[model samples]
Target: MSADYPSMTTAEIRSKFLNFFEERGLKLYPSSSLVPDDPSLLLANAGMNQFKEYYQGKKTMKEIGAISCQKCVRTNDIDCIGEDGRHLSFFEMLGDFSFGGVSKQQACTWAFELITKEFKLPLDRLYFTVFTEDDETHDVWRSLGVAEDHISRLGEDDNFWAAGPTGPCGPCSEIYFDMGEEVGCGSPDCKPGCDCDRFLEFWNLVFTQYDRQEDGSMPELPHRNLDTGMGLERMAAIMQHKTANYDGDLMQHLIKLGEEISGKTYDADDYSGASRSLRIIADHSRAVDFMISDGILPGNEGREYVLRRLLRRAVFHGRLLGIEGAFLTKFIDEVNAQMGEAYPELLKNVALVKGIVASEEERFSTTLDNGRVYLDEALDALADGAVLSGDVAFKLHDTFGFPIDLTVEIAGAAGHDVDMDGFTACMEDQKARARANAKGDAWGSFNDVWVELSDKVAATEFDGYDNDVIEGAKVVALVCNGESVDSAAAGEDVEVVLDRTPFYAEMGGQQGDAGELSAEGVALTVSDTKNHNGLYAHVAHVAEGTLTVGATVTAALNAERRGFLRRNHTATHLLDAALKQVLGEHVSQAGSLVTPEHLRFDFTHFEALSSEQLKAVEDLVNQQIFASKPVVTRVMGIDEAKAAGAVALFGEKYGDVVRVVSV
Candidate 1:
């Protein structure tokens, strides 16, 4: 460790990184919600997810540049957590971006200055990597005074970063810290590229220059954008002079709690299994605590399934330490206390988080015993070398909450191997079945046509919140069964894209507006509306005449239904306010749906709401309605609204401007 490097807490390290960037004129952006509103993603897996609209040209930049410490979770590395010293299910990413103002030169210069001058780390200990063929980044690193020998030119698989199969992508330059040769794999080629413990990569700087299309060809982006991410835990471990990320203050409190509960010491060389178990428990505690604080509950699919798996794994690992009977819930307080200052939501939802974890632990405890019995029976019936069926393993996973790792561990002890390929196939089949049965059905992925159309036309103008009838709206495009059509005749059900709409699309847990479109000789009934690539597509059934592209129509919302929607929408806000007043400030809306018949709200509460409590909430809402609390609605920027103490939904995506409702 360098003697000049000052020792700092994890929070301090995160603060220093953001402060350094903000001093250079970068606007600070708060971390976005863990749940993603994009249909392609389950969670906000990266800091750039919130800024994707700006990159794709659907929305303009809020600022020329921004800085943030984003909270992210990735389960693809879940299986590698305890086995390695650096993998974490939950971690903070300190990032700085330049939308179009700065170039790669300025980005490289700032990163180097902060690492060397601000943080006071020795320059000799740092190494850089760039794309093999990208002479631009290579030259920039060299211009920053990095030694030629200290920079490595690597291939696309190593230095290129992309969001997905097709989207914004660029070649990246990564900074690595040399931890020394003692931890190396004892090979001559054990450099930064080697997968060894000797070199630790801490930050990645991406120069977003290409817009990769679905056809595998790369075109230059409209503007050369810069995006960078530095792992907070990794940097903390280095500054704190710790060998492993979990050994630092970021996880020490939870690990100590694990030791106290299990009555065991964490010794890597003890071989008594205490060290591995402690690491697993400590890591999982953070993931589970943050997820529940964000209002996620234990369930069977999607983000819910991921949460259930994490909690169950933590409980099972507790069993390994000889700690049993819902002990994982006890660590919730420690998790909140350790990191709640930066994230107040953790403290607010502490009680509900503990409740959810305890309930899940209790449920999985019983399922474990039953799953063991089934596993033993299967092993006894199988021949000596026979493999376990994937269907059987998936049943234990889907029906019971048994992780496949446990099943594999038990089967391996009995001298048998699992058919992993079969298990994977079964898992895929289940996912497909679930998607087919979803409420959105196949319509969820019907946005490709709109993506192409958005390139030609501007986003749809929303006028429903202000006007009930939007006259002279032009029809932009039409689609029937995923295929674009020029015209749709009478009695044909089709999706219609318009230049301006008076219908509210399905968003923020609110139902879409039901309305009608009328022309001289044509009438169409819009059964529902959905937001696709910033365009509102009305799922309309034409009752008469052909609706053609480039034709004008008058869009009007059904007066009766619109009245019901307004009442239910206003009631939802009142109920939200009442829950905070009646229960506690910790209560927040988890999910909601407003239909003409009724309004449903799912909030963060540990236990079932009692009849009296339900009655109290109902009475308060009714009272507000009777008082006619002058339902106030205004259009303002998101920042102004938040500063005025307006409540923001947890998982809803808002634009630069938002609609604020108050009573």
Candidate 2:
């Protein structure tokens, strides 16, 4: 960084990226929730996550190109948070994307201009890395006047980009800045590709031009899309001339606040561990704040478990800072006050966020004491350099809510190492057991069959809100488990796909419709319907005759059951409104289930509802029913529905046109 360069905050850095792209005719899109709609993902790990369906041809892009600062959480490196200066559990990715609208030349040229001209960083300190065989990217850099020595061609592990086993993938080019030799590894070969901090990578430009097939072949994608990600915190760090990201303006304030709370100075010789703990607390606080605001709660599985682990880690580190009891709750307002302008959702959910954090802190304090005793005993049993058994560590985690990181930390202090491989095997065994015990066939795997089906099938059209009978509907496809079949005989259990139907697939906590479908010689009893990706799969069994493909069928929903479903669904809406009115705006739906038999609604509340409060909510819902308010369903854009004050479900994904249900 040059002393002559003007200082820029993280907010300003984000604005510059968005403004740069908007000026280039890219639409600005708001950041999506940290919780993703994709079942394969636990959290939105990248800026391109929200656009994956578009890349897979499952959903069409609403705009040709767009730019956004997506809020992302990546826990693969959770253990590296405080140890490394660059890794963060939560960070903002400033990105600009092209959906078959821009060429590589244009994208590369603009990235160069933004780095060199707008930010005014020295051009000589920058180096580029490309895939070993990607001569096109090499040519692009050369044509942009980059020196040959300043570019390095790396292998697939370093330069190739892929989302998963199969999807849109291609070669990527990364931009690294050469910090001074003081941060180098002293091998005399310090360059862009070195592991040392001498070269800090700030941006990655992914040319999504190929689709990686299941057979491990790279084929050309339908469109040459450009996906680029630049870390907002890293950019700020570079501009501020700081090697440690914690010293950057974006995090410095929080670090200072932590110092005030703990009464310990960061970077002081006597308090090195405390300094690291302070940094962890600051970083984890931001992640927890955003997660809770997204309607995630501390729990025992999936996304909730991730949140619980992070929150517990923050609490443990807070203890290391010498601040005892419920200290993390105080940082909620601090994070909101600092980042609320960029994300107003933080401010909107502040009250609920604080309450949840405080409760978790209080709950964990007791567990932390119990866990410490067990950890001490285990450490006492181990000699210097001895490894702790993974099963023991896992038991500490499972029974006492102890995190693996804390175990590793304590064991290291005693000069012992943790058997991470053993720990991983234990965790996997537990997950396998849980899956074996899981109910229903609802748990589906992401394989070639599912991906190909999603690409080949059109979205299922739904008309259950209006029509009870679906006439002239065709059976498009049928599946039995992972196998696709043309027809099914009597007593065969299979998943039937219809071209169009009046059945409401299970979504937004509403149960799937159970009905009957019949044709000239085919009849099937529908037990449940589900929106699998975009394909609505009717899980049914052939009761009377063989159901075959290309057969026109009359899909008749169970009218009495449909009425019960409607009443339950409408009551859910009423209950939602009544809860908000009685429990304050902090009441937001976390999960829901509506069936003819009953309706179950889970919401974000710090404590259990009182008897009187429950009665009030129940009375309010019944009063609406007795008043005989007409159920209104309006078709409009999602934005219009939101502006009209419709309550959006927390985890529900909506499309361009949404059906707004109102009482």
Candidate 3:
């Protein structure tokens, strides 16, 4: 089926690929259809998208031959499109991957050579952008015999594409097909990444040689790779001599159809609904079909929300295009008959996809009335035109998932401007207010010299399940009020003393337990407990007698809190194991919270916990509880725990003896 690709006209270019790679003895393979499950990414956004697990060292590439038609999504610049000449929301990347049993120089040279020779592109028309500090790619390009003048070096921010805070990130060199002088002069400075479109990015070659880690570090990858993504539609536009991507091959069909539906020829110069609707129709039709083919049914959040929003936006444009009766679904067959071979899911799930799109389309058909009213309200807010309030904006986003763009769209129609700056400020203020309230921001920072505190006397560890009471050790330090006085004052004396008390330290997602210390029958209340530098500081207030250093006393802690903390802490470990058991091996703890009520575990599962997976995890956790598993906590070597497979979250460094808890 892959032999007979959809969009065969583009296959003219595909034939050139097969012959060129075959001449070099690199096996050709069909692209994978699997969607990535990384939670951080909404959808597979690049040709190399599905292979991320392999590139990130999460999974090893097992296939020998791989060539794919990868569907990619990029939403970062959604607001800029429809007005720009070359932007398209959804696109397919024609890709060829080499697993690196071949020569590295050959892979680099061949990619450059094939485009210039086999593709019959002009040599001077080609420009190469390399990472500024990347000696590997630089050497490879020069070794390929490209003229030095044709190569451009760029710093990491522009040339290197990092997914995020961590993962498979490395230097990348992109192949740009110059559009000649007619596209206006190069960006003002005529510099790389100057927001100029004169250079039509044709293909990207990511030599994934290093895997970046969660801690902003890099590890050498076992298999150096050659991954490439050519913009298939863009190629068609360039080869066919068209200025706009939508005006080229496949979309041209969809564009003309939208024209018929709208009863108006789209004017390229305007941002009117007529032009937007055509772009929407041409775009949304392709996306909906691809999503359905990938088994993504519409729901809420994540993929479903994307599908729903895309459908509604298309429908909103249909009001612009003047088409009705679930217009999006009607276009599925054209997509199926057109691109179904390379992506068979299109024809396979047409019924299911059509059903879902139709049902949702009909459901939202009634919202036009509501949308009109919402538009009026937004316009009213724009009347004062100073700034939009956060609560009102959030209300729109929450109540109807009404995006700022849609609000802006309506605002444009009414000849008014949105107070975006005001809206954002008000929104941030409200968020700060909420966070401050929750964290007791109500407490104020006193002016300097108000409360002088003293050095803390470290509290004794409860040693978990042990003798609750212990003979008090010598008080190392003592203080009164804010002053580090030698003795407690006559009134209620406040002190932070280190006596060997069995109170537990607040750590490992567990709260510190509280108790009291008494000497010569004079009781002192342990007001609060905290930890600093591996030491538990017991905040104490004298109830009867004066407090002093070298005072020996009886130390006690709250038994109930200790018991609850133990249960919750133990349960967290069990849930961690349960998650690894249910989810794939990639699952790792992100963060967690533990209290007497329950343990909330955050991990790297992509989608929200499915009802079934959620039930399974909950059941597995409670099953551990039912087993009444003895909670064991120990201080062991950090290496010992790591070798023992203990869960470690990001940004936390461990000392020699780390607290390893197991149920």
Candidate 4:
């Protein structure tokens, strides 16, 4: 709060941080998509997510070091976003990473220099905390001329960092800024790790030097790495001399838009009703915009559920501020205007963002009204201090599309608690019933048989991409009457798996190949080929002599049927592209089915296509087909394929190497 310290905008801070690292010889890497490619994460929660392969030794490090401003989404603190000064559902993590290239001393020194000289923070007010066991980090900070009293040593819980239960982990050193005694607890024990607004932790430097094994042993990594994350909003708040992150320039524009929409003013000093609602609206609008731009739509499960919750929470707060109708979309333009330069994806997907937000807003308007009535009735029926039953909560969610978090919020406000355990039980019960109804007993039994066979047989080798017939393929496993068998006589239905075959299994919405299996003394009629965790099962019935496991046979595919399937599958891709062109970029594939006869493509669209629009799509597809462009297929790394603009479905887990088809 001194005149000597220059106040900087959020954008300036972001630029300066990246430039500082770039000047130090770190290669700049663009932020990865919020929809993480890693299966373990629900969303990209940190800067290190994209560099996971480098740390785990799966992918070799190609650069000495790297820098990025990663856009991250964390919802565990969602319900508390507007209640404090620093929590956010979405934030940018300014990070610099090194894979066995930079030492801990260099990382700590550069971070200190960036904070004091580059950002011009008052050196006297900054405090550091090193892990208790990390003597190397402690000595490094001492060598930097820091007062010994200003640096604190904390325990593992406060200073240890890990990506998960196992994997790359290390001791962490944190930097905290003092906000003066006015915001402190006024206790003598107050320090950097205190849970108070007085000491704000803005950056964490993780020296990843160990690989934690499954047996709970921590062995030193062959090569040490450095990963650090500085929160952009936190830095902005400190640089701008603001007490709250929402008051910073990064979110002020969105807050101003909220005020204009609802005729309410945001009070930075107050963290109560109207002020809190304004802050939630501002924070959630940014999250909603970025999520939609990344191809995550509002829905009821997984990442979609996260987006829907954020959007609905913002909308609910708007209603609290007296906003009505579809007002959430009003913030999209402002979001794009403010963040478009740093993240051009926002600008490119403006129409899609607005369209989806508006549609969801319109849908939630009726849902909110209906859900509130049900909630009020339930709350009224409940006695003071009595918990709301999960059955009623589930009813509200199932019948009215009300989020459970929203229900918990309302219940808490009324001085009541929810039966979360009961709620979880109810949810699991519903999921179990739905699974049983969808898969049926027969399929369940078939899956159980496959599970047993998987232990005895390795994955089937797929040769169907090119060859139509595989000779001398040995049968590895056989199943008859929903049980594994060594042999199946003639006239009995069975499923067989060969060590290698030329049969295409059902995958990616494409129907399986129809073929035949024959040998010197046996024959089987193949009806469908199914993939079971990489094992190809040819569903068939013995027509001639007995077929036994380990029997060498000829696996032949029906080439004519496969040709039809190939054409239909190709049409689906063309149809997908044409729909996007004719409708909008928001048209993402929801589901699909490709068969030898015809194909079904399901997608996300707000409205029905008109006859003229449908005609345009048809014409486009026909034009592509008539042009006779060569279709090329090549296998490449996932990153390379993405660089080539190969479209990927959201939530689909892809391997390192992918087969990409270009038409």
Candidate 5:
């Protein structure tokens, strides 16, 4: 924008929003977090994602009304960045939030006031768009003195906001900053709202008025909210007299830092895609740095996936510049030194965060070479002149971790085009694999009823390791393909139920319990223990006794299986810490399993684990195991646990207190 944001400095924009709301009697809270307690999201995609439980009535208000500047990450548009002027992986949201009650009209009025009165911009430069179906937003905007002509009506796709299938969702009215061009106009003559960046949609006011159902349907919400996010960087670009977002002072500083480290000069030149790579590197490094500092490391799936992609992208650019090693990690300090004051957490754990990035890059560097070699193999596949579809290339990327761009780049180098058809096939197959489940065949009722069973099972104390066999409790329920047997003998299989037992059913990615459920001559070997029709249904692979349905049975978990589980469980913690030490502080565990073969810990870091780094982590974990350190569990307040330097896992909602284990 040629306009110097015509209002305030980046710092002023941040402070003005918070201060205005604070003076209006709203609780001005600092940014809460970038992570979420919800697993459905890859990252804190929205300011409201972390506040979902609050909007869903799962948690009470920390305060009745509050305002915050939140750090948010969105991967939905990952493929669309670099070319766009606005989309970014990491961005700060200047938000005025409310936990309790405040009308949408107030939301509209305050937003209008903040832009007009506080920012001191020309009123004519502002425009508002509301959902045509939302009478409330329309009325509110009108009440706030926005001229009816200045407010455009858009369908739900553009003007309504929903986080997920079932959560707070409602109509949104976006406030736009007019660039005095064709698309910025509210007139009927304006070309649709798609790509003319003439009108930059900056602020959005989402009224959480609906909740979506599991079957992909929407229902009304009781307590609506005012959720808004205006990007600080984008806003700064307009306020700082920059044509492009990357050209802004904030990102330029990071660009300069990235350039210096790579021993490559970044300037406007025809070095093929080198300048683009530099820009991407500069942008993505900041994204990864901020993410790691905020406690997200790179891993395989979800947010970790985003980190992994960013890390690899930056490193790939490094290779293009002839830079080597885990140089991206070293820039963590540069990021901290530059933006740490704005985001202290980045500076606070700078060392740990850097190590995570450094280690991942070192690992991904090799992966990159291998990935390139793998593409060469694909090029070999293309030598016969058979069209290599995107599917085959995608597999090389998926199974072998080949960077997709490298694959395409290599293909282009080989004078061969990729099979766009094959890639789609492979992509669809992966989606199917992700969606398929035993429960899927059971209809929607499977999860609906079974989820209630975990709640129904009396908090059975699982002492399987100490003692697998326990006294019998009454059968809670029965599940059968046919009629119930007399005694469920050793070889005659039958579904033996349990009211309570010491069995630790398969959960947390652990294998199901397999042991004998016995009563006198009726000994049933449980091949699997899973939830069926809201009850723990023990599948006895082999049984002979004709057990009656109501017979009391002793529930036992397999001793060997439990021991294996313990080894795996204990190893998980060891590998987790080792990963942090070898990788970086940013290496928060994403997911892992300790199987009979070996321990696997998925962590958030940009690059893959190098042989040297992975070996170091493996050695460190083994060292702890050999040291015979006691894996001690301590019960204390959740706050105390955090204060005691305990690591918290994602998607776990701890109570006022928590159970923390340390070695």
Candidate 6:
């Protein structure tokens, strides 16, 4: 049946889906940033992330319906990616959303028309699934001329959709395509919801009509919404008559580039060795490119950490393919060239992407070399078929950034096994220690309190950038001894929130400003400042008088201390540029600390720098300091800052508007 239809590129399928819905009056919207605005999500894993507010009734939508091809990143299946034909860390989701405009019948009808008529998929090969209790959706599919036998009623686990534990919840109907009996598990009951590759579920239509209350009661929403998502790559694979999504036009180009760089041909049947490496490289390359273009960088925490893992995994796979030196940038260039048309942001960020990839590759190459020595020693001590201890695996991962899966693969290839259980225990132990240390810190243990206070008080207005003093600032909230309080007496340590402040909260590796908050019959010494979700909390103690919420205070920053801090902060930036100049562009800042007395800059390097190299870097920094280069600061959009070639530090989150500092 697929033979009658012309094979289409992934881009073509995407266009057809958008155009089909657009012609039907659905407004088209571009993909949102992969870095989601929602704090609960690490990355934009779904097409509905941008419209979540609308669905929750927190925000209203101007358009009744919208269609988009959103770029999504999901790493929950990272271990499964490249091992299967369908799993991908990064993919485009073709979605059409309705806010009380489109109905269940319309959604099913449009989806059926697009798949069968526009995409030319055979109707006989299609199947549908609905929640067991959703009679309305079942009847809609039946009325659309789908055979009763083709529609399967699935349980809540498969057909019910929920935003969370409690929120907008409803039943969903999914469309599946059968790939013939030969490719499926031989079972008489194999159907649409079967756990087999033969039934490929390509699209899901969600009918959100109920608002679930905290008490588990689901009341019908006043306005029903429709949200449907279809995987672009999956549809392209079916249309192109390919078994694997990687074989489609979009990913095959990347795989071909991998073959060229590795000097190896990809074998579709070989899933365990070189071919698997090729597939992983192809997948990770695209994910890494998109993540960087979306303003994410390789770092040690949060989404930055996810990007680092993907990037390093791709590099390791390249090593498995016997590719030496830096080859990821080649793949990055191909990604930009092929996908730039659909996502022009990739084209604009090409230089930045390549530079970051090259830097991580260089650092990983050195780490891999060092880790191999330790891994070899551990392997030599183990007898054939013996297990290597998890402590060793943990050390390799912690000290050298080596991945556990890589360790397992290498050990298995050498006729040995790894103590995965022991490795997991070691990881847990480390986390426990980290949690313990966090509890001991004054700032870390009060996070929940700060979150509660943030809800009650408005965000602090920062007035410290230009002036050292902010007069007549009203205290909005106060916390004493980890508990919210109305007032604090003399010699009591407390956290004070002000409506406006001149004290700079600690951020971006810089120390918080030390200041004094004074009012009539009040003298409080603010030792440090910390920001919790834009609410600045001044950690202070009453020196003489009583201080309470609603008291008008004058916040005065120590000018002499701030002068020294500014000098040291500028020096750290100079040191960063000097290190990169002396140690190649591969040198990237790993971490830093900027205080009034001195500054410490941590960076990625292959090994300890020689005395000569250190002297050279020192001289370069000194030269910059002596040259008296004008230190200019400009406020602009993040895109403009990147376009102007401003270096953004990894692990530092930047908002839409950024302050770019240049020397």
Measured against the true structure, the TM-scores of the candidates, in listed sequence, are 0.81, 0.84, 0.59, 0.73, 0.66, 0.70
User: At residue 263, what lDDT does model 6 achieve?
Assistant: 93
Candidate 4 per-residue lDDT, tens place, 1-663, comes to 333588999999999999999998899988998987565567898998877656755344567799999999997778798988888999999999998889999999999999999899987888999999899999999999888988999998999987567767899999998888888999999999888789899999999989877899999876898999999999998899877788799688888888898999888888888889888988899999999888788888778988988898888888779886788877888888889999987886787788888888888888988999999999999899999999889888777778787798899999899998888899889878855555222112222566556645788988778899999999998988777889999999998988988998887788988889999889999999998656799999899999998899999989999999999998988999999999988777767899988999877676678999999999999999999999999999999998999998643558899889998
Which rank order by TM-score, best down to worst?
2, 1, 4, 6, 5, 3
Better of 5 and 6 by TM-score: 6
In model 4, what lDDT does residue 620 have?
99
- Compute the lDDT for candidate 1: 0.83
* Model 3 accuracy (lDDT, Cα): 0.65
Name the lDDT value of residue 580 in candidate 3: 72
Model 3 misplaced regions, further than 4 Å: 1-8, 14-30, 56-65, 142-145, 186-192, 212-219, 267-273, 374-390, 403-406, 409-416, 422-663
lDDT of 6 by residue, 1-663 (tens): 344667888888889899999999989988998987666677898888777655644344667699999999998778788887888999999999987888888888989888888988888889999999999989988888899999999999999998666668899999998877877899998998777788998999999989877799999876788999999888888888877788888888999998898899998756778888889998999999999877787878778888998999999999888998889999988888889999997886676678778888998999898998899999999888899999999999988889888899889989988999999999889878855654222112223566567656789999888899989999999988778899999989999999999899998788999989998899999889999767899999899899988899999999999999999988888998998888776566667899999899987554578999999999999998999989898999999999999998855778899999999
Off by over 4 Å in 4: 1-3, 214-216, 376-394, 397-399, 403-566, 585-602, 607-663
- How many clashes in each candidate? 0, 0, 6, 0, 35, 0
TM-score quality measure for candidate 5: 0.66
lDDT by residue for model 3 (305-343), tens: 777777777777786565756677766777776677766
Query: What is the alpha-carbon lDDT for the whole of candidate 2?
Result: 0.84
Error of 2 at 71 (Å): 1.4
lDDT of 5: 0.68
| Top-scoring candidate (TM-score) | 2
RMSD of each: 5.0, 4.6, 14.7, 8.2, 8.1, 6.5
lDDT of 5 by residue, 1-663 (tens): 234336456677787878888888877655656675444444665555555545654344656566778877777676555655566777788877664467887778888888877776566667788888888778877777777777888997888776644546778888877655633445656633546666777788877767777787777665676777887877776666554566667677766776787666656322246556667776787788877766676668656777888888888877877776667765566667667787777876676677677777777877877767767776786555556678768877686666667777668777787876788688778768866622222112222423344444443344454577787666654445544334443445556557666666664445667788767766677887664432556778545455665677787777777788778877787777887787666556666655545656666655557899978987898888889866777789988998889987642345687668788
| Model 1: per-residue Cα lDDT over 1-663, one tens digit each | 444567789988888998888887888989887876566667677777677655655444556688889888898778787876888888889999877877788889899999988887788888999999889888987887889988999998999988667767889999998877776799987778888888899999988888788799999877888889999989988888766788789688888899899899887433236788788889888889988888788787788888888888899889878995778767888887888999998886787788788878888889999999999998999999899998888888878788898899889999889889999999889778976765531112333567556666678999887798988999998989877899999989998889999898887667888889989999999999998877899999999999999999999988788788778877788888998888877678888899888988878766678899989988998898898768778999999998999998777768899888878
